[model samples]
Target chain A: MLADIEEFYRLDRLPHIWCPGCGNGIVLACLVKAIKELKYDQDKTVVVSGIGCSSRASAYLDFNTLHTTHGRALAFATGIKLAKPELNIFVITGDGDSSAIGGNHLIHAARRNIDLNVVIFNNNIYGMTGGQYSPLTPKVQKATTAPYGTIERPFDLAKLVEAAGATYVARSTAYHTRLTTELIINGAKNKGFSVTEVISQCPVSYGRRNRFNTPAAMLEWQREMAVPVIKARSMAPEELEGKIITGELYRGHAPEYVSEYTKLTQRLKEEAEGV
Target chain B: MPKDPANIGKPEVAIKDSWCKGCGICVALCPKKVLVMNAQGKAVVACPEKCVGCKMCAEHCPDYAITVEVE
Candidate 1:
């Protein structure tokens, strides 16, 4: 409805290349709005992503952006954060890009507790690569590779990152757009590593392969499956079966890697001068 | 120019036609039934007066095509 245009978006890329019902656009909007609400200096903020459907978000965002190689977005982002800790870095990675080929980078980054805001677009399948089953693909969810359905259990990325040492972690769906934005805002505010895993829909890749006839149906499924963190606590484990627990899953204090590295260098500099 | 007559004093729910992909997300998610997909499939405000300015349609629009101003 913006008559002029969203200042945060690249005018040349007015209409994004995402599929008609793909939730990538919604997640991208959430990320940008979160950045706006935080009043971050656009010039100081950097958006990075690896190759995939969701990674294309960097092309539309009007900021210091990077389109890195496959599954290595976190590695590139970590290097950037180390080089220029003052700039706000946001990684826009897909489930496959973050959890499959780049899985090791994901764990190490969370383990380091670096000050980077990561937003994983968990669309389940490897959409850009033509519907291959990714690591986060829910168990028994059909993909092109898994003609019937995936047999392996999917990783609960929020729990994975929390255990790996992320200071803040949250999971939200594209249907819950406002909640996704709010989680990103809080995650960005966290001092250490923050992960906001958005359960975005891949209507073309994941839906058609499965039984979700329309994107609306998938959205409704998300609505039915999502249970807030506060509400989930009271329900018994059995009652939570098949329900996705969303909201702030974890928030803890930790020594940020960047600051610790800076401290080490400063101490060495003082010691050298004293000698 | 074909604004619904009932929209006289309603909060504006403006939608950019060019950007809309007709995903129907805004229409389905609009709790007030204030939006509908026109014949061409772009979303239009059917009853702007019912808009509580929650921005459900605006915020959830995948194409970033909807906007609402309560004031």
Candidate 2:
């Protein structure tokens, strides 16, 4: 299909490297749609990805995309945001890439409140590296490393980022495509460290091990478990058991890092001129 | 001259077969069952007439193989 989005993608990279039913593709699509909706200059938009199946998106997208070291997408994106604050920066990362290997960077970036839009593709496992359990993998979910279900609790990434001081934080799943796209758009518009954790499906790895039989079944599970932010507020703790909250979880207005830095430098320059 | 008057302004469900991974996500999520997986494991437009133009299949294809345009 020669759709409008076709131009935003590297046509030669047709049929992305993602596996069949990989939710990474859906998230990627949502991201591109967000960019389109915002009318952001493709030339001025930068897409940064860390090492993983999700990181492979950089190669397929036609914009200025950087496929960086494992779990360092945020660092690279931070540098880009600081150096070229005029550009719209986006980080596409997996749960393992961001929360496990890049956990420190994720929190630090959020604390700084940089104008970086991050979409964590939380597929719950290290899919590209053979189904190893990740920091976001639910407790008791079986993985290659955890042959008999893990005892450790998974990180609530949205809450973690919100607590870490991100100006905008949201969560959505692949099943909620429209909402995912909308949240991504809002995340980009937040003008500070914005995190949109998308609960994606790793059918080949996380799904089969977890007995989700098929990718469609995994998507269906997301649909059943998801509750909008408004609905979640009324539900009691016990009633919200096993429910995934979707939608804009938090939005705080804070001075963006790059802009603040520019102001500081401008002030310093004026002082130097006065001297 | 358009051959089918009923087909006028119908939603266009375009499936790029080469890119389809035969995931059947579009078929499964389609509210109208307008798509089905072919014998070759690729998604195909089974009932173009039944399309409701929701674009659920297009949005969730994961493969980006389906593009539905509602005229």
Candidate 3:
């Protein structure tokens, strides 16, 4: 199926830093497959990431990559898009990198409807920092920081991005590889800010601390929790509790930021020249 | 590539042990149950004859450890 995995990666960086059975590889594979299917120009594509285990993806991919400061991937990506509107940009960020400290940037990016694809690798806990409870960590979940349990509720990533006015929003788990790849392709094709929240597994950091001690168990848990968006529609909210509603959650046409800026600058120049 | 006599006319499933984390996903997802984790915690072909070249294990493997070749 995906025969060209090596083509999308920097072979010198082989043997990624993620632990065995980590779902980050699966998400990366889906991303590579989506890029292949889209036949995007690698020279014109930029992969940006924030500080985290997931952010390490920028180093592995063979693209014009930018590994930015912690929780500032979208902000950096915004500058890149505004400077060079023709570039295809993809921001790979973790739950904590996006929703915790970068929450304001994420929401504002969606509000501005910038044409950039954002894929949030939501593994619940901050795996790179040794299992700190993140904004998307489910309530009552045990983390290194919250050994007893987390008291705060988690952010519904898809709903948050959708409410913030992203043109395309979708959710899928690492267990659903095909769906995740397809959703990423669709998100890249969308004209405005698109967020695809992939519920990934962090076996070493999150699983070891929680009851899911193995990668298989963590993946099985995701498999059991995921419900297709269409099927979830027929079920009541109470019945659908604790289920991951996967598939495209929202899609709307909007004015993309970079294009609007280009138009504004062109009109200003024309008025100045008295054309 | 010349076919090995041992696997001549048979589908070959190769597992890169170095990359495999012994997650058992390939074993669990294999429709024919042709794969299983060995004592060393690496996936091994349990029933190579039953393998239909479906590549489910290869597709689902998080480590990219499994590859299927069908003649």
Clashes of 2: 0
Pairs clashing within candidate 2: none
True contact recovery of candidate 3? 0.37
By TM-score, the better pick of 1 and 2 is 2
lDDT string for model 2 (A99-186, tens) is: 9999999999999999999999999999999999999889999999999999998888988988898999999999998899899999
Instruction: For residues B1-70, write the lDDT of model 2, one tens digit per residue.
Output: 4537878888878898889999889999999999988999888998999998898898898988888888
Residue A204 in model 2: shift from native, Å?
A: 0.2
Which is superior by lDDT, 1 or 3? 1
Best by lDDT: 2
Question: How does model 2 score on DockQ?
Answer: 0.71
lDDT of each: 0.89, 0.92, 0.89
Q: Rank the candidates by DockQ, best first.
A: 2, 1, 3
Model 3 chain A lowest lDDT segment of ten:
A1-10
The recovered share of true contacts, given per candidate in order, is 0.61, 0.75, 0.37
Residue-wise C-alpha lDDT for candidate 1, range A17-46, written one tens digit per residue: 888788998888889889999999999999
**Each candidate's interface RMSD, rounded to one decimal?**
2.0, 1.5, 2.5
Q: Predict model 3's lDDT versus the native.
A: 0.89
